[model samples]
Target: MEKPSPSRRAFLGLSAASLAGLSGCLGSLSTETDETPGGNTSDTDPNDGNETDSDNETHEEPTEPPGLPEGGAVMFVYDDGPMEDYTQALPAHRTFDAPATVGIVSEWIGREDYQSSGCMDIEHLEELVDAGWEIASHTSEHTTLGTFELVEDAAPGAERIYPEEIRHGYHRGKTIELTSDEHTFTRAVADYGSDDTGGYIAVDEPIEEACLAGETIIRYPAEKIREAMGDSKHALEGMGFEVETLLAPYDNFDDYSRKFASEYYSGVANARHGKRVNDPEGFDPYRTRRDYFIEYTDRESVKRDLDEIAERGALGVLGAHTFKEEVTEDRIRETLSWVDEREITVMTLREAIARYADR
Candidate 1:
């Protein structure tokens, strides 16, 4: 089930303080670690990179894509932890001997009636966690980690979310201004580490008026997404759920995002547009340690990704919003067929964590 909720303000304050300490050592923070892939989950690095490593140097080791055990090892993961996720996604997991993990927006569990939309319900959520799907954090709300990609993902001009009015001229009616999701989020992210100079807010709150005056792709809103991360970690752990994976809200990430995703969650899954911005594994865009980007778009694609999982020897994560209109009930069923094929071992994020930890 759910654990006692922490005070949001308190958690935010603490997280900022912690991040600050990291910034102090930021100069020497980027030093390379002896992190290596393969060798089971044992090789999974725990850096979540939550701390500031700006000063340390980074080194990339030449590694072949990781391959799974003999046949192939795959882990299925779902995001948002919504009730529909519990209702629709979990059954497929059970049929296949595969365990799953669902990341959640702590605050969105039950406020279904909120003016601003939220995520799942508590009872069904409890049922899923009790049944074995790993429950991880997606922040207090479904906020993006760092600035989101403004170019293709989001439409230009003031990303409008709600369309209500508050005596301030139709909150977002008839006016699509050019803005980034830098601070905008369904749920805000917990800005961890010691840097507290910038508090959290909507993706485009910290006005760079001069720079962002005209039409320009908005920046990813990492600050709000990372708010209360420490408290969130505590909450998840307290709920008897291990903090294991992170889903970049809409796969919105950047250099700093990768660092924290590595530091806080065991793995992170983002959309693989297949476009290498700088380099796939570069600071701007990198290989996700948690699992492979999902390919559950179709049954054939599912099979292809599964084969790739085996070929890579890395984990293949199955992701869905349960809310996506595109991923229908039928497609979900078709996707699970591959999980049952026995070619891959199905596991939850927690199970993956345990397996890796054991290794």
Candidate 2:
């Protein structure tokens, strides 16, 4: 079976593509409309209801909207941190003098499978940093944080392990990690099933019969979430990169994950697929948005997405994968060409996030 790519979902409201589908998604371009739920970016402080600055006085909101570098800002973000980026994607971006933020799976770096699968190694990631591309953590192994239905032991002090650190079991003879708390488990019970909607889940009682069923854990607990975040950030920092951003694998994260991310990352790239266009002046530093780029996405779709960003003066964050069969050189070149024609400014995630400081 072919491998699966990331799924699309909304961040705070409708996705950018879905918003585009709406009759008046961009009607009047009113900055007054708060698209994100409970996100009042006007006079409200992002930190909390306490809008007072350090001086114990109210901070004034900027009268003018924040501006992009030139025409507009278009940020291309590549996921899974594939090595082909060094050989292929990077060259294409350099062709247009564009910059991108590559989400790195820290565990995949220098691994045998990563090497064979064309995932980028540490040196390649370093080279990307040298070349001015921003490197963000795509989690330690691109592990989806909260998508598992693990059979657990209800007994206190049961065998517990971090979800991302899980290393055993098989779903239909495939190695399954991030699921049930199966410390000694090498294979799932007979009822393991996966489908188009749900990725993988236990479908029968056989899994429970094998052991006293514990509370079903979703994503990593708070501690484990912290460990994973710290591990990935440290791993990249060990490679000499000033890491401060995280791109959640599959763009999936729980509230706990977001909390821990703020401790380690300056910003996290967690957003809806089509609704990634964000205005820097009204930027949310923690819950940054992003868009997806698949092989099937046509040039018109790309142009339309960029055009939406340009028109709104929002920072368009486009995402892609390097090692997939669909991520071809020609496609990358084509996307770069679109960005070039639009005169969009290409910057790393760090550079983009810095604008929020002045805002």
Candidate 3:
């Protein structure tokens, strides 16, 4: 479920504006923050170098070995809402005996509105996991990482949502209102802070420490990226799902966020804006690429993408959402059948990571 790409004119405007704001603060932005393994709590010290080398060592990503024996690996990833899991993907997986991964926004599990006809609740997610589908984090809310505040705490008795405060993407800062102690949603509020420029900054410096100020149009500080990644992982595991992978909203990643992902998750299934054709010999686990299944006009076009993956001996990840009209149940069935006919290896993100990523 990627939002349409910004127009070239709009993108240029944003880039220009961002550069003007980032130029002056570039040097000061590299200060360090202390971090425990999973939580986002931090205390910044401009001179601290204690964690600098360790952080650098942590994000020096290595390429994964080609894990498939014959044809390249093909992972069918269902992104965003979960209703498609029960109504569509599950049946296809069961029919084809395929294993796919579903990336879910953790807080939407049981809510009524978010559980509408096309969306799935917690029980439905559990069913998917029971049927052998890997459930990965699409974050607590599907907030656009570099452009918005990822999540904010909400009081139980108060409004369940605050649409205005939530920014930049489809699911904004969500309120975690779970009733049970077993499902505590931890918010590392202290781990992130806003600069005078209104950019949400990570408390921790990236392993590279290459000041992000003027590097990208938008930047998600290393700490906030960790909070979103760590919180989502904790929430899914708290609810009893085996979580290891992350699916970035809009297939977007900044270098800092990618580094944070490498630190927290076993693998990242989607990175870059769209339809990334990966090179197997030097595939990056943190920035694993994918193409949208719905974007192809015909079966032949999809097969061509698959053929490319096979030719390159790459781990090709394909993304889809059953809720969309273009991504129908019939389409999934057709795709799976085609995959079976092609002898392509279809595995969950977890399965791929176990076989391919450098642990």
Candidate 4:
């Protein structure tokens, strides 16, 4: 991985004047039309009440319209708080005056061992927050929030231990089911423990029947999911960044995760996939969709999605792993340029939700 050179930090100062000029141009464009590009009136009539207002009466200055552009909006979300976000992505976004949101894996920040692998430190993230970016929770340790199959079988009443190390998903007070080819047993986890070998779930009730190890373990118990959500938020907030969104690890989440997300976050990016854009009206903040920018992402397909979002006046959320080889700074710049040409507003996920989503 390439580290940020001193030259890049110097370049940021040089870009400010150009960014100011770009802002001016956009401001002028917004004021040119009485109605916005989406055909909604930008300002309301001040004297429509009587239909016979006196000429001397003072009219209230038209308040600036909402921050979202009528044409459409796009939110750039970078998952995993990697140093590249500060080193590579930030400078490119600065060139375009575009603000983004970054999902942070709480435990990874500032660990020296992880830094070699490109994990960002607290200072790096603080800079992003200062640069108009929003910090979002990716959960502690980047734990998988979705359900997975059990690797071992459990005898009646014994602690259910798995073959693989469990990073998360089990917590006291949450119910889990052990299902096999023939039997399914529901039990509340009385205790949860993990070690170098694997994770174990303790249940007060003895299993009346044995369950096959090859089958699924259903969903992650709810309390543990909440702990992941809440702990990440608290960890980030303790560092003084306001966290109001979640980008579930692996784009994996279910009703249990989504339900818990509402308690901690204002919106969720990568809440679910397969949808390109979110409807501006009545969009579910907890169910917001995202398209990933990956090694095999087709640039043309991305452009088409942006075009559709602009044409429909909907919201588009794009996710990326900035540390990857395929996600170069130049690629990020090119994408931002396309968004700029279409007159689409690039904002943080929180801003997009506040301006567009129902919640």
lDDT by candidate, in order shown: 0.45, 0.59, 0.58, 0.71
At residue 85, what lDDT does model 3 achieve?
Answer: 68
What is the Cα-based TM-score of model 4? Answer: 0.69
Candidates 1 and 4, the one with greater lDDT: 4
Candidate 2: 10-residue stretch with minimal lDDT? 1-10
Off by over 4 Å in 3: 1-67, 115-118, 147-216, 220-222
lDDT winner among the candidates? 4
lDDT of 1 by residue, 1-359 (tens): 01112331222222222433433434232323212221222222467725335556444433221112444455555766655675567675555544566777776667676332445675667777666556767765455444322222223342222211111111222112324334322322222222132211233333233223232333333443345354566666766655655655555555656656655665554534332111111221134343223343345555676776655544555566666655455666666665455355555544333233212
Model 4 per-residue lDDT at 229: 82
Candidate 4 residue-wise lDDT at 166: 45
lDDT, candidate 3, 1-359, per-residue tens: 11112341122222212323332333233323111112222333347735444453333221222224356678888887657668877887888767688888887775556534646877888888776678889987675564322233333332222222223323233222111222323221223234343324232212221112222122334455667788888998998877777888766665646667766676788876566366666556676878777654567778887777666666778888677667777888888776677667776777666545531
CA shift at 82, candidate 4, in angstroms? 1.0
Order of models, best lDDT first: 4, 2, 3, 1
Every candidate's CA RMSD: 15.0, 13.0, 19.2, 9.4
* Clashing pairs in model 2, backbone N/Cα/C closer than 3 A: 16-274, 16-275, 83-119, 83-120, 150-180, 152-214
Q: What TM-score do all the candidates reach, one by one? A: 0.54, 0.64, 0.62, 0.69
**Residue by residue across 105-174, what tens digits does model 2's lDDT show?**
7888766566346577777877777666788888775655443344434333322322222322222333
Q: Which tens-of-lDDT digit does each residue in 1-359 have in candidate 4? A: 11123442232222222433434444434433322222332234546743434676443322122344677888899988888888889999999878899999999897656534668888888888778788889998686676656677766666655634343334466566655677766777677677564676667677787655666455555676777788989998998887877899878776757667778877788888765588887877788888875455788889899899889878898888887888889999988888888888787777666555532
Model 4 whole-model lDDT (C-alpha atoms): 0.71
Whichever of 3 and 4 has more lDDT, that candidate is 4
Q: Give the number of the best model, judged by TM-score.
A: 4
